[model samples]
Target: MTRQHVLRFYVALIAALTLGVLGVGVVGVTYLSSQTLIRNLFPAALLIAVSWYGSQRRVLVSESDIWLMGTVGYIATLVLLPFPLAVLAVAASKGLAEATLLAKKQRHSWKGVTVNAGGTILGVAVGGGVFASLNGVSYLWSHQLDSVFALPLLLVMILLYNVTNELVVVGAITLTSQENPWSVFWRLSRAALIPEISLALVGIVFAVLYHSSPIMAAFIVVPVMFSLRAFESVATLRRETVEAVLRMAEHLDFRDTSTYEHSQRLADLTRRLASALELTPEHVEEIVLASRVHDLGKIGISNEILLKQGPLSEEEGDIMRKHPVIGAEILDSYSMFKSSVSIVRHHHERWDGKGYPEGLSGDHIPLGARIIAVADSFDAMTADRPYRKGLSVDDAVERLKAGMGTQYDPKLCAIFIQILMEEGIYAPSEAVPGELHLIAGGRASGGRAS
Candidate 1:
């Protein structure tokens, strides 16, 4: 389905889920008290503020994903309020905040707001229903040792809430990106699960404080806000580091346009291969990162050797091979990029043991490196170089097939070939190279050492 259709369907699904919960929630609404009703407003207003603040300083997950840090508010609502009231409060506050705060220029702003609001409503309603069913609310409202004893039930509530929220967000992302659903879900869960649990724990604290004295709960928001700011600061720092690396990669791209373009195409193909192989989100991200900077060591290569038109002489080749080690060393300084360092260093290593800095054969080489090798070889063959014309996509496939179990991991090569054929990109460059090359990073320089 088209993006709009998918979005419409998603919004419809959210509405259906929210309404389904609401039907049962109304029955539970009678459980709410006048004092509880008044208390609900505090969370609603706070959620509005949080949502507005979060929208302004969005955490970038990827082109298609944004990490929303409003879980505390939702969890607080679930803990302090019951059923329909909690769901209604979330919908009203989140909807108002998103409508006011979301950029007008963003596509599907209204529909996205609806999905966001409805998703929160469904999560709170369903989670609250489950919590109430297990008599979990007594833990938050009652005296000493209640919450301590009910820890297991509280955990279950958090899980259900997060799972519901994650499903809605993941479904939207999958629909919009047209990526594999399982991949999208895994990526979201890996990044989000810890933070969501932490926030839920904080929310429990908020609930406990509110039960003792509403004023105490109000005071806790200050520390919670500060903790969120710390999370944002760390995320910002990581983003800046990634940007710095990309800038360096762009500098390398400038040195040899072909090599840069080769990185770009190779990154794309490798990501496809990694995802196809069902690697974890973390591994997939590492492989994609390694593909982009696989030639980073080339940055250390002399201009004479780097810009050399023909195949390198044996001496030049020796210098060129050192790029992987140089690249890994450069990346090693950053803790966040450490996982990718091995992938970068080993990307050129061959399956049969003749390739690169490490002659470790087969599974001994990092799997990420193995995936990049297959993609790197394909992009190198198909990419247009100054000296020799790029091979046809068909010829590239033939080369990959021939190199199976030797130059490349046989499984990776086969999967990549299947990706090409399944996508009908037998001649990608002719149709739309820009659209086919779908990873972040800039421009073309196709050559890389085989």
Candidate 2:
């Protein structure tokens, strides 16, 4: 589908989900005391605020939320309030979150808000319905319910809530992204399961304690939640920075009809290669981001020059070689991309110290840059360009081998080739990289020395 068609379709889907949830929620609506409503605002809005902050960061693949605080709010509201009241509390919190997002101009698109609000409402409704059906409200409201039984059932309730939200959000993502539903489901099935469970238990503990010691729960537990939020804040900032860099990168690729194919393919390959080399997750994420925007400096080059099909004149070559420096400088301006700047600055540097911008050779070059160099060259060789048909993947692999020593890091290139040969593709693998040995500055591991 065209971009407009996709947007129009998702808008309708979001509206439908929203309206349906509102309709079902009406049935659950009942009068709650003013005191209960007032009390819920504290946990609900505070959680929402933290959640609002957390939402600034996005995760990969399906691009759903990772709001531990928000999840806690839903579970807490369900455990503490009646289904109808919990629904309102959840809605109120979400409404407030939307407002905050809008006021700060932090929201990227209305579609994102719609998907978030719609999926959340539906999820809460389903979770509340399940909880109420299981006599959970009775247990929660009663003063004499046994702790042992309540705790176990509360776990089930939390699971139900989490699953309901996950399904609604994941389903929407599947439909929008056109990713395989089964594959998405399997990937997300185990994603954040532990964190969800742990947060649910925390919510249960809070609710149970709130009955007798509201102050303690509010003081101790809330602070603990804030601590988690602190970490999430750092992550959010990092993600937001990377996202900005990506937007700039996309703009560089936007004018062409290929839809950023070169960068995207390179990024994907580099990620697989990084994994096979036993790089840490953070290292992998940085490498992937760097690979995607490694050529970002090309945007600064003149289109007439960049579009030239044949070999460039020495002067033109000099201009082209300036991209790494430009890209690195552009990235360096962003504090979050400091580490990535190193990779971008050095991606063109060769094993033999004969490449552009910097002539750093061998182990002196950043490992991530080495990885990107290989992936970038492979994708460039295998992807069709204006000048010529691309090479076959096998031929591309052979080309990589041909340049293995002089152009790329021998170890990283070998690991990438080994992994590719073994798996036949960069498909998801349960196999971890062989093993890793600590390298200089510990940026990239030596990985069992090949």
Candidate 3:
């Protein structure tokens, strides 16, 4: 079956199970005292409203994951209300948010809202039920657990709730999106994990004070929300700035003939290589950002030169060579992109001091720029251009090997060739010692001229 069909089936099954659970909770309200119900209902409703607001002001964490504060709302509710009540409150919050979205003329997707709510409620049900089974509803409804001093159990209970919540949420997200649930978990679990622990601690502290003064408990939420907003602004600015860089790169293909994806492929490979080299995540990310706009200077070159079917004239070549400096100058204006500016300016530099712009040699060139230079050269050879046909994979590898000491970093080029051979991008049979030696130096770079 198609992926959409698969998702629909899962959604239907989840909806049925969720509805049944909520139905059972509704039927068992007789077991809850009116006083108990009255005490829990307002906090539940208030948290629901708060969660809906958070959902509206969510932050994107990845292409797949988002940082929504709804879990913060649910965690607070789960610690103070019964398991059934927690589920109902969380679900009600989602339902209410959808209504608000509709009122505002936004697309309140049923799949987006329902699956997420259902998964969250399911997780709370599992966690809280386990907590109640072990200690009854004492912690759920009283201040006793607050002073228990049994830190381990309290932390364990909090962890159980958060972990269950994460698994369910990820599953729902996986079903709705193209990303693998496990991969998404591994990638973002850390980002969300720390925040979840901090928020859970906040909830536990708030729950303790809640019994003393509901108004004070209410007051705590305002600062927390504002703090999150402040943090969100910084994170959002970074993401939006990266997006703007990508949008600027799209200008490379003004008439729809530019090899825009060439930059994308180079960026992907450059990041991969940086990671393979065991570079820090920060350096890898900087390399990625630089690769995205490495060709930005091409925008300043006239279309006549860019679209030329033959070799560039000396003047045209001169204009083409200025792209790296132009790109670096443009990026230098943005202080936030300082990490990438050097890489853009020096991506054309050579290990043997024959490269353009500054002609920086060897390790004198930034590692990020060296990585991009290799990636850029490989992509240029492999990609079909108006002036030349694309080279075969073997020819590209051979050409990169030829340029290793002069045009590329010898260590990185050797490593890159090894990677290509291992991935079978180049024939494994060609990986004999004779070929290996050729990668580092023995052969003349001018042995085969284009």
- Best-fitting candidate, measured by TM-score? 1
Against the reference, the lDDT scores of all candidates come to 0.71, 0.67, 0.70
For every candidate structure, what is the RMSD over all alpha carbons to the true structure, in angstroms? Answer: 8.2, 16.2, 12.7
The CA lDDT at 334 in model 2 is: 84
Q: What would the per-residue lDDT of candidate 2 be over residues 248-334, giving only the tens digit for each residue?
A: 889976566454877777778898877665443444676787787788888889977777779999999999899899988898898
lDDT of 1 by residue, 332-378 (tens): 99855776798889888888999989897987888788888888888
Query: Candidate 3: misplaced stretches above 4 Å?
Result: 60-65, 102-108, 136-146, 149-154, 172-179, 233-450
Candidate 3 backbone clash number:
0
Q: If both were scored by TM-score, which would come out higher, candidate 2 or candidate 3?
A: 3
State the RMSD for candidate 3.
12.7
| Local lDDT at 83 for model 3 | 66
Per-model TM against the reference: 0.62, 0.49, 0.54
Per model, how many backbone clashes are there?
8, 0, 0
lDDT of 3 at 184: 48
> What TM-score does model 1 achieve against the real structure?
0.62
Q: Lowest lDDT 10-mer window, candidate 1?
A: 441-450
